[model samples]
Target chain A: MLIRKPNPIRSSEITSKDNYLNRREFIRAGAASGAIAGASLSAPAALAAVIPDEPLAKLADIRKPSPFSTDETLTSYDDVTTYNNFYEFGTGKDDPHRNARDFEPQPWSIKVDGHAENTGTFHLEDFVKPHTLEERIYRMRCVEAWSMVIPWVGIPLADVLKALKPTSKAKFVAFETLYDPKRMPGQRRRVLDWPYREGLTIAEAMHPLTILAVGLYGEVLPNQNGAPLRLVVPWKYGFKGIKSIVRIRFMSRMPQTSWNLSAPHEYGFYANVNPEVDHPRWSQARERRIGSGLFAAKQPTLMFNGYAEEVASLYDGLDLRRNY
Target chain B: MNINTRIRYVLKPLVFVLALLPAAFVVTDLFEITGRLGANPVEEILDRFGNWGLRFMMLALAVTPLRRVTGLAWIARFRRMIGLFAFFYIAMHFAVWLVLDQGLYLPGIGEDIAKRPFITIGMLALVLLTAMALTSTAGMRRRLGKRWNQLHTSAYAVGILGVWHYWWQVKADILEPLIYAVILSALLGHRLWHRRARSQGVTPRLRANQGAG
Candidate 1:
């Protein structure tokens, strides 16, 4: 007889409905405590002090241990939140954590347009309310040859797109991050044009593996991790996972992506995890898993980040080397 | 004590301590004494050493201009130490990439140096730095004579390559690398200006600085 061990993180750790409702109160309390923290430490440290201590609004009714989930050791919640590539906040891995402390992802809305029947702005809550949330533990491969396994809580993009009623002409889906420089300090610099944009083919967008994540590790998404909503394409490089989404448009043509626009030769439209196709300066053959200690050797990178079985057919005849 | 004695005792040790701080900080961070290296400690360590190496190279190059401007010949005494520290930090950076990052994967290391332009340039700089470091002693300086000065002129080439290596590695937002490029340009331009001035017999003061340059 096999003995099944209980998982460390479960529904018991999820926030109660009352705690979820009192999120604003918690934020207000956080702000007050942040002010007190400011007196002792420097400005950035003060902001950082408030974040790890405060309880995030934990997501409810998350269906975990899904068939789609990976059985990998989860990256610590602190590492997941702190080390990020949300260029909207800043370019440095730690910059987002430090700078996005005061970012208000609350009262957010997303605008749906172009080749879709649902063509108006809707509150983020309304967009999320319809579907059953799932916990997808995926291997997130960065273009910089770093990897992480994150437990994301989100609804399938296919389910959300079905409600939007995309037309036959909708061959691609383009997503845009919020462009407010006041909140997103990095937006002021024109790093890769003001509003960072990413796109996916209609087929890739509708894949069950693709999700629009609203939370991570059973908690509401932190500001640094793209609060409210963000795209999560498990098979693609992390840059394809656009953060802090404000506008999502269905289009006839392949949409322009920010990194591709920045350097067309280096970054391409189809940013799949292909170990064979090397970046201009670095090898994509291997990735250093984050939180794997200092001396660990980089593991060999997998095709489509080990989701080739699920996503390879989407690009049946396409040359990933050329597309990448 | 006389000024030379004071310089030898007080200034040299102070400069040594100041130069060693970056390495000290890395060791402390590696041990997580202050817990400041963030999530990826190896990357932080690697980047910090590389950044300081470039900074020290800049400092080594700046010594001539500083001595020329300030007329403080004692500053020249620190140049050798500074140049050696630059080598030390750069060697640390390369060691980290080889041992910790690549895990002594010889084939991968060779591929990166041969294929990648940035790594190729960085490797060239390291080779030049190694040659210079080998011949840095006073005995080697006397034995090589005129060839010593000729070989050391490659320092400028190393400076340019270091900056270029940094510029190529950056994904986007070239602000930091751009700043390094600008400083290198200034240092190179200063040398060109002084050399031109010395050739034309423009100023006696300028000609006096040629020995150090």
Candidate 2:
């Protein structure tokens, strides 16, 4: 005998005329409120939505905003990540965002060798474990006359160099980005010499502000924004901050930077942001802030990108115009 | 109405609208109705204007060659309009760079034009285009007489300079500029080939109003 109980479908679940009308009205009200919320918090909400869903547990402790942060509004994370000049990805501004989706950044290793006491290839996780990550909100000025305020998460390069114990002969620190033609389609083009390289003088590398960044905006760094590890020298042009670093070599002589090798006259090893000296192609006296609306006025570029008090003394005796 | 009359009345106005469309699109994008300009709107605007300017320059240069090949004399009538539109876009590009990018910094603009190789070449092309546009009127053409043809012939040089400016400006991924270079080379090559053939007394069949003046 089938003693089938009545199905336990709730009245709310059933599409009754009164309930259906009420549900539609509720949905309409909800959508209207959402539109209002979106309009009011345009920048931050848009940024939050675009931040990739990666394991951000490493950033748990270092998520607080830094004291060193500028009062200037931070550029949205979407703009910082999507609009990049990582030519290894491609030349187009949005190329890195579109092309680097499948890039394998996890399970990465960095080879730390050449003129260092502790010269060995180490897992990226192991390298990052020792240091206390700190948040640094920095004004990133590009040689192309654009700028952004980035929230970077990493230990200072000075601290990392201290661990390595660079030999006295190590006068410069040379960094190399990963070279995988299959992963990086732009590598097939002869736009730059393969294995993009950059170097900083030992003094510059040891500067307190110089960071070996691993994350941004309270998340694991996006692949386009140099996942795993990268150098961030806020006082210099954005290109000086090499991305996707795989090798860190301590060289005795000034190492050849990628752009300097390609166009020596135009791009110098010391790419410090200077308004007085202009790139032959354009003036550097002003810069358009990224993520600012089209009609927004260009801001006057500060000397050393407003890090003049800290970094200007680094070049006190040196002739910037001549070096530039 | 006759074919010539139909082209002058209808086709000419249509071509004018087509020529003006790119600029109109840029304006609409500026208003954010169509968020086509992306994050860096100033750069996008500058780039789009420059692109249209270069494209119009190519079209203007293609007219004579296309007319000769197709035996369509009416095509030659749109050349002045196309050339003027090219100048218009280039001027807008320069204006945006000056006002929006440079913030009306006259000295900086001067320095860039004087110092930068790419800017120098681009300014030279603009100067040539301006001269051609000013002399485009029938009265001015008669006033300059034979010299008018001589001045207008510099459009070939303008085309080369325009392409060179584009090539020099790019940091990498030069495929776009390379395409322009190839097209310019082909157009110029056709002229050279035809000249050589004519010199050899081969009297090509498409010879109608092919005189240098």
lDDT of 1 by residue, A1-324 (tens): 222224312432566733543464456456556555665475343333211223367676678788999999999998998998887788899999889999888777677878998655566755775677899999999999999999998999999999999999999999988888899998888677757789999999999999999888888888899887899999999999999898888999998788888888999999999999999999999999999998899999999999999999999999887889
* Model 1 agreement with the true structure over B70-187: per-residue lDDT tens digits: 8777778888899999999999999999999999999899999999999999999999999999999989988988898888889999999999999999988899889999999999
Q: Mind giving the per-residue lDDT tens digits that candidate 2 earns over B1-213?
A: 998899889999999999898988888887867656767888998999999999999998898888878878878888889989999999999888888777787877888888888999999998998899888898998898889888999889889999999999776568999999999999998888888888899996577463231
Native contacts recovered by model 2: 0.64
Q: In the order shown, what is each candidate's alpha-carbon RMSD?
A: 11.9, 15.9
Error of 2 at B201 (Å): 1.9
What are the clashing pairs of model 1? none
Model 2, span A22-70: residue lDDT tens: 5654564465557546755854443222222363433655734666667
Tell me model 2's lDDT, rounded to 2 decimals.
0.83
Each candidate: chain B TM-score: 0.96, 0.95
**Model 1 global lDDT (CA atoms, 0 to 1):** 0.86
Q: In candidate 2, which residue ranges exceed 4 Å CA deviation? A: A1-58, A63-67, B208-213
**B106: Cα error in model 1, Å:** 1.0
| Off by more than 4 A, model 1 | A1-55, B204-212
